[model samples]
Target: MGRMGLFRDAPQGVAAVASSILACIVLGTLLERFGPGNVHSGLPTFGAIWVVTAAASCAPWNYALTRFFICRTGATFVTLDANQFTCSLMVVLNVIGTATAEATEWGNLGHGVTQILSILVLSEITIHSGMAADTAWRVSLIVPAVFCLVTATGLKLLRRNTSTAARLDVSVTGKITKSLLWDSFEVLKDFRVVVRIMLYSTSIRTELAMNNQLTTRFRTYFLMDAADVSVLAGSFGLLNLVPYLCVHYVDVLCPGHLG
Candidate 1:
């Protein structure tokens, strides 16, 4: 199918869901075969490392590439909607995964499974469902090289006709000179922008850094095991959905304001 069919209105929701299911199946099989305490005796050390490495390597660039496509096409509302939708899905899945883990033998492994699935789904969408020519060439080469080594024909499946690069103004419109550095310095001299940047950076860093510490503290201070910590963390994820919902509604209610 086409990119529009896969991605739908805001982003690649359908493709993401499909990829998540497929990843879950693949990971589940691997886990059953090589996970600790599973049917097989081998540890999934390599598999875990591969997943984390792939995710960490591709994640930032994936977001940037997606945003580049959307913003170049002037789909600002679509970008906002996509963020809200993805965040909401994360919150819901986190809760469900946590609850399932707590009630079953999965423990924190359940959370890890869903997270891995999400990462794989995101990678799939970023590489395949994105407008082909608009996607970063490095990303395009890397994804198929990694995932389609066995199939070899998978690169042919990526959409070719759809590329946002055509719509984007990639040309340099202004004269390039050493004064560009001075221009940046001039902008940075604005006290209001400086304060805003600082505040935004601080909050973002705090949020990112807190997750590991929070999980660790849950296990250490509260004497919670993996399952208990998962439950607590998932509860926070569920709470996070409230803000995403509100953000969505704000866009709907106010149209061009918040979005």
Candidate 2:
């Protein structure tokens, strides 16, 4: 999408993310409060909530945003080349200017920073505020939700006086077809594509498994209490965040060089 188009659609996108986050948080809180289970099971409950929210809300919203809005803006802007490396590079460089491979790295760095912030905030809440781990984690989620909400509100206000022509038009030109699913399956025809997908999926699953067991591992191996574990986790997060910050600053200072 053009910068203006992206700007106009920002509110809806932010609102969708905010709503999904809030929904997951609320559902998790309710489950923990009323469900009869060990407190440790709270992690699974939150994970399940996240999966459902992502599938039901976030996925569809993102698809629509990419398809109807971004695709409609221009096909050149879409990074759908067959060369995986080129496509990956274009995704990041395209964000700043036209070029093409460091977008994936930038995206990872952004996610890592957010994750670090979340871990640190939750650790602080658990240790200093003396809140339960379950409660502190849920409370930490409020930060992102509020940030998204505020961003959505700001975008909405900014667009309040925009002309109709400048506003985002989400209407599709014709009836949608089921061919999208069939087209998506066409990717499986390429062995490389299938292998790449499998590798990516495996990596994601591994990450999720490690995240789920992270706290238990720290407690078991280090003989740490909740507070100590939190501190340790936050320390790890800070260490991770520092490199990301440096890389991000370099990328901002010299755009496309990383690509």
Candidate 3:
């Protein structure tokens, strides 16, 4: 990112990342609770199939999908660039929620196993035409969750790989703060790095926020019943796997790209 102004000291950059991650976590949790929508939509449903599928989506998004989205959206933030890396914290927090969906539902012990693809969403779609009300709500909750998780993860990996290729002009040669200071701070001395970093950061937050809410709001507020939500969610989870297949071979063309 041009923010480093020659990669200034990594101190500022790291601090920025730590701060952003913490903010995203706190905000995401609050947003998850009081933001709006049904209880499951706003909160993690440990027993909810929708939540589990969404959780799986986290692996891709948290790992590589970030790069694909950034470039596709013209955020083209460079991989490993200190300034923009902070923003990745947003992706991570999202993943954290998705990953924890199973835990949220475990019934009693606070732990549960998530399925590979959700069964709930498909059931909702099946019932969409016949069973209304409760079934519909179910679908709305689960299906959209599936879609959200899949979309987020897919986008993260896509953007990360693309940015790694675009590599910014600055080098990450600065030392990370070692002793006290705090874990979150990193420095960016470069001007160009600062500008470019800001350029990318400017677009991502809103983009993520909107998409995160759309599936749930659109459903709970508008479309089908809860059952319908679940079915829709499972469908997304089922389809999300198709992208991972691409990942297996992605490196064939671009060695180390998946890494």
Candidate 4:
């Protein structure tokens, strides 16, 4: 946030992060205290807490990254196009790998293939190269951490040569102010933004709900095993590529027609 000028007042960003961490710590402590026995027993129990805490820790930096990119692009569509293209491409590749795994009955091998495609992590290759699972997992995280460090360094270098105004800085309190809240409600008074938000929210929520229910539905209705369910899941991702591609090309061909 300091780097990207996300906050007009830099201390506001620092305070926001501090507050988030305090909240997460409170929540995690409660969970740890009164949660179920099984929750207290596993890697995931602590891992889940760590993930939330980590996100809180990284919030400012991630916001800085997003703000930097948005500024760099100058137009929202360029960022959207790039993000959607990358997301779609990863989904398509992962789905392809999953399909191949199903066809070949490679079990966990298939899963690792799709994981690599989705995350661009070479942990699978490391595992195959005789690295232990725990070691491979640790090493896999290091790759992204290193990449982020490099990317941030590059951005800092580039930013040194560019002159741009810092955008409107909204603090946590300012964003939640009574007047701002009312303003948000007023803004939603615009039918176009409301309609888009509603439609997108509805579709995304429905798809996510269906995705969550799918494995059970496949097991009950089709008697498919976990592996088969994975293959079926991948098919939806594969199908999404068509519409994603269409959206990309439409934006390219039509320019600001839709906008």
Scored by TM-score, the top model is 2
In order, candidate lDDTs are 0.35, 0.40, 0.33, 0.37
> What's model 4's TM-score?
0.35
lDDT of 3: 0.33
Across residues 1-259, which tens digit of lDDT does each residue of candidate 1 receive? Answer: 1222312232433333333334332432342223212211111222223333332333444433333322221111111122311122223442433322232222223333433333354456565767452343334334423432322222223312113321212133243433222343465788986795586357433442343245556755788654556556555434444444454355445644655
Instruction: Tell me the tens digit of each residue's lDDT in model 4 across 1-259.
Output: 1233432334433433344333322332332233211212222222333323332333456544332322221121111122312122223442433333332232223223443342334435454778764344345554444443454444334322111222212232144432222343566678996786687457533443344345446755788654566567655545544454455455455644765
Candidate 4 collision pairs: none
Candidate achieving higher TM-score, 2 or 4: 2
Regions of candidate 2 where Cα sits further than 4 Å from its true position: 1-101, 127-134, 148-179, 202-205, 225-259
Task: Summarize candidate 3's per-residue lDDT along 1-259 as a digit string, tens digits.
Answer: 2221312223332333444444433332332223212211222221233333322332333212222221121111121221233223223443433323222222111100112123344444555667553344334455544554554454344433223332211223243423223322332466775675575366334333333333455464677554455444434434433343343244244544545
Please report, as a residue range, the 10-residue window in candidate 2 with the lowest summed lDDT: 73-82
TM-score of each: 0.33, 0.40, 0.27, 0.35
Runs off by more than 4 Å, candidate 4: 1-47, 50-179, 255-259
Q: Write candidate 2's Cα lDDT for 1-259 as tens digits.
A: 1222432343544443344334332332332233212211233333333423332232334533332332121111112211222232223343432222234334333333554565667778788999875456556656654554454344344422112333312133142433233444565799997796687447433443343345546766778765566555544433433453455466566754655
What is the lDDT for 99 in model 4?
A: 34
> Rank order by lDDT, top first?
2, 4, 1, 3
